[model samples]
Target chain A: MVTLNNFRKHYKDFDLNISMQIPAGTVTGLIGRNGAGKSTTIKAILGLINPDEGEVCVFDKNPREFTPRDKEAIGTVIGGNLLGDFITAEDTIAILRKMYADFDEPYFRAQCKALELPLEKPFKDLSNGMKARLRVLIAISHKARLLVLDEPTAGMDVIARSEILDLLREYLAQDGERSVLISSHISSDIEGFCDDVYLIERGEIVLHEDTDTILGQYGVLKLSENEFRDVERQYIVACKKEAYGYACLTKEKQYFVDNYPGIIVENGSLDSTIILMLGGR
Target chain B: MRGVLEKDFRSYRKTVLLTLALVVLYAAFCCLMPGFDLVHSVLFVGWMGAVAAVNEVADDERNGYAFLMTLPVDARSYVLAKLVYVTTVQVHFWILARVTLLVGTLLDGKKPDIPALLSKGLALHFGMVALLMLILTFVIKFGVKSILYLAGGLVMLVCVFCVLVVTKPDANWVDALLRIGRFPHIGIYATAAAIIATAGLTRLAVHFMRNKEF
Candidate 1:
């Protein structure tokens, strides 16, 4: 549903240049650290920023060329409000109902109530968790075909984060054709949700693998220096120095488990993959 | 555009209400208070329009200007909606101003020439209100801080208009509008020019907003 061909944005100290795609009917996660260009990529896809070079296409058309009808299918939550702090959540829902043709008012109000959001409170008065919940609610309230979410769970407690993810899970379950591109600095936030994961570091994609492979097949082999020399090096995706031995990141977790009985193989997560890849040789 | 207009109307309803109260109170002042006349009241109405438009634009930016841009509405339609809302409110206030003036003159035991007064107010405000609305496009682009600078420049212009109002009211630029009404041939030309200018400025505002990053 979204494609970026050599998309590049130039800044004084940071340059974002990457090629990526999110097919329809898939939840793709763009995981990266803060200031790692995740938001920039999402902005380019949403036409919030013009690419300094290359093309960004959504629904097979340049976002800038998208008509109002074209945009109705997209729902985005990029850590911003609909109106300023002056309007209440009720006012926001009213505005959204006017803004979107397919806005499900009953579903939205029910979700708001389920989430314990105060309907009449101004947005500025809402707590951080409430504000976050409200943003996600607005995104899913409309029956959008594509959701481009940038850091939807940035600052929240574990329960709040879980609640936000549950909202997305519920949204995804409602429609098979609906797609999402959720970016975040927290690996665990998108780890269990996304179908495939894209690990970005310093505006570069270090790895792109399905969530199944990352969780089931990938592993980190902790071995002593002498044992590392004896172990197969071909499957290692990344290697890092450690106090006791070496930590090797490999996509073929079962391969090492079958061969190297002495090397400790731990199931790989996005967090370990990022750590090993970025800090490893 | 309807969505954007409705959203703006509801979001900025408070500002509109305050503007309504101010317009009513000012109209009464023009009738009962010494030294408060049509010229002063018209300028004040124009200024109040600026306040309402600027306040709404500021609130939009402070909250989620970027969020609004992500909506189905294109930049052009969004800008057009804002322009329409500002002008519509200003027009309503303007009509109230003229009605108040008419009643005030009639109630004070003066034989008011209703048609002439109405036409004269129309001729004066068409250009005045349009000018203020166009200037307001700057607030939408640069945020509310720009309003202080814009108001400063406008206050200087208002000062000049006040000088003209006292010394050469018949010879001032406002009189040019009255003269255009006297000559229907010139009225068409002036109107076409005004329409072209408003459209051009609105287009320019959209262009500035098209690539804006949230």
Candidate 2:
């Protein structure tokens, strides 16, 4: 649903150069450390910031050229304040109903009730978790075909996060053609929810893999210096030298396990996998 | 565009209402006081419109301009909506000023100079609208903080000019201003100039906003 081709944006201290695609009917996760250009990429895709070079296409149309009707199919939940502090949930709903022709007022109110959000309270008075829920609710309540969520789960409690994840799952199930591009600092949420994941470091996408393949096939092989030297170099996606020896990330876990029985091979979690990939040797 | 206007109106409902009330009270006071001048009373409408315009811009900036940009509306539409809102406020104040002046004249049991009242009112209205358009252009280009500083500097300059005029009433610049004020068709010309300037500044503001990021 979204394609970014050789996108480049230059900041005073940082330069973002990235290229990626978010296919329809899948949850794509963009994982990166802080200042790794995740939000910058999101901004570029949304046309909130102009890229120095390259192209971004959403639903086969340039974001800058999108009319209000074109934008009606896209819902966005950005980090930080999305509305004035004095605006209440009721006010937001009222305003959105006028802004969007397909805005589902009943669904929005129902979601707010389900989330126990006080409709009359100003946004500033709400807790961070409540704010997060409200933002996500608004995004989904617009009958959007594509949901672009930037750190939607940040500042939420465990229960709230789980509820939000469930909501996303339900939303995807409701429409087979719907897609989502979510960026979050919480790796486990991405691991559990994403169909595909992109690992960005210093404004560059270093890795892109299917979540299932990463979970099932990827492994970390810990070895002594001699064993590391003997191991085939092609299987090591990335390696980090440790106090004892070296930790190598490999996609051919079974090959390593079956061939090198003496080496310690463990199933790699998303956090450890990213650490190994981003942690320069 | 309607959505944008509705949001602004709701957000500034209290401020707009209070400003209208204050302007009305001040107009009444001007009419009742000894040596009351309808022309001076009408000038208050301009000041009130200026205050309302500045407050609206300040509130929008303070609230979440970046967030508003993320909405479905385009930048041009956003700028147009703001202009419409300000114009609506100015028009409402203009009507009030005219009505109050008319009622005040009838109450005083004197023949009202309808043409003079209209000329004065039109001049002030157009001038205020022009000033507001310029301010909006600056605010859009340079942001609220820079505009606030500019406004402060202008106020200081105006104060100094007033003091100079009071101290040297016969100075060359002061005499020139007095002569311009006494020009037979000055009001109509001033009004026309202000209207033209307002249109030009509004176009400039729209162009600046189109290029602005966030």
Candidate 3:
């Protein structure tokens, strides 16, 4: 549903060059460290910021030239750009009702009631969790075909994060053709939720893998110097020297378990993957 | 654009109501009190319109433009919506000012001649709103500090005007206003000029908003 073709954005101290595709019916997670060009990529996708080079296309049209119909097809919860803080939930409902032609008022009201968001209370008065919920609610309630969520669950407790994820899960379950591209610093959130994850560091896309492959097939082999030297290195995606010996990130976890018996074949987690990819060779 | 206008109205509803209430109370004060007349009504309308427009601009900035840009709105639509909202606020006050004029005439045992009062009041209201648009379009471009500067400048001007008023209480302000009001179709021309100026301002604002980073 969204495609970036060698998109290049250059700031004074940073340069971002990325190409990726988010097909319909998929949930893609963009995992990154702070200042890793995640927001810039998102801004480009939303047409909020201009790219110095390459193309950003949503539904086959440049995002900058997207018409109302194109915009209505996508929903967004961009960071630093949320609903008016002084307006109430009822006011949000009213505003959104007018904004989106297919905006489901009853659905929004029901969800608000279900989420325990006070309709009469001003948004500024709502708790942070409530505010987060309202922002997500606004994005999903309009029946958008694609959701570009930029850290929608940021600054929330675990439970609040789970609730936000649950909302997304419910949204995805309802439709197969709908897509989501969520950018977040929280690995665990993206790890357990998204189907695929793209690891970005220092404004470049370092790794992109299916969550299943990252979780189930990938492994971190903690090895002695001799063991590391003797082991086959083709499957090793990244590795770093440790005091004990070396820590190697391999895509073939089962191969190591089968061949190197009793070795420290720890499961590859999002966090470990990030550390190795970003901090290791 | 309709959606943005609706959101603005909803956000500023209470403030609008309170301003209108002030209008009624102030209108009554001007109508019955000794040194009050059309000029006071003009000043009140102008001040309230300027305040509402600036306040709305400030609130939108505080709210940030991220949420606004995410919607099915382009920069042009966004600018148009803001212009419409500000104009609507002024129109609400303008109509009410006519109401106050009618009530004043009834209390004075004369025919409630609203048409006679329409042109002068309309021209002044539009002129003030136009002046505000001239300020607001740039305040929008330059962001929050410019708004604060604009507010500060307005306060200073008002203070200076107040000082002038206090020092020259004997001056025939009413007669001067009457003479200005009698200028041939000055109201019609002012309204037309304001509309064209505002339209041009909206275009300029659209350009500014487009080039602005969220």
Q: Top model by lDDT, which number?
A: 2
Report the poorest 10 consecutive residues by lDDT, candidate 2 chain A.
Answer: A78-87
**lDDT tens digits, residue span A1-281, model 1:** 88999998898999888898999999999987888889888888998888889999999999988898898999988877656766777887778877889999999899988999999998889888888888888888889999999888877899999988988998999999999999988888888899998888787777889988899999999989999999888889899999988999998999999987877999998889989988899
What's the lDDT for candidate 3? 0.83
Tens-digit lDDT track of model 3 for A88-202: 8888888888889999999999999888899999877888788888889989998999999988998789988998899999999999999999999999999988999999888
Superposition error at A140 for model 2 (Å):
1.5
Pairs that collide in candidate 2 are none
Model 2 chain B lowest lDDT segment of ten = B58-67
Candidate number of the best DockQ: 3
The alpha-carbon RMSD over the true interface for every model, in angstroms, is 1.8, 1.9, 1.6
In order of DockQ, best first, we have: 3, 1, 2
User: What is the full ranking by lDDT, best candidate first?
Assistant: 2, 3, 1
TM-score of each: 0.88, 0.92, 0.89
Q: List the residue pairs that clash in candidate 3.
A: none
**Model 3 chain A, poorest ten-residue lDDT window?**
A78-87
In candidate 2, how many Å is residue B109 off? 5.7
Relative to the real complex, the DockQ score for model 1 comes to 0.55
Q: What TM-score, to 2 decimals, does candidate 1 have?
A: 0.88
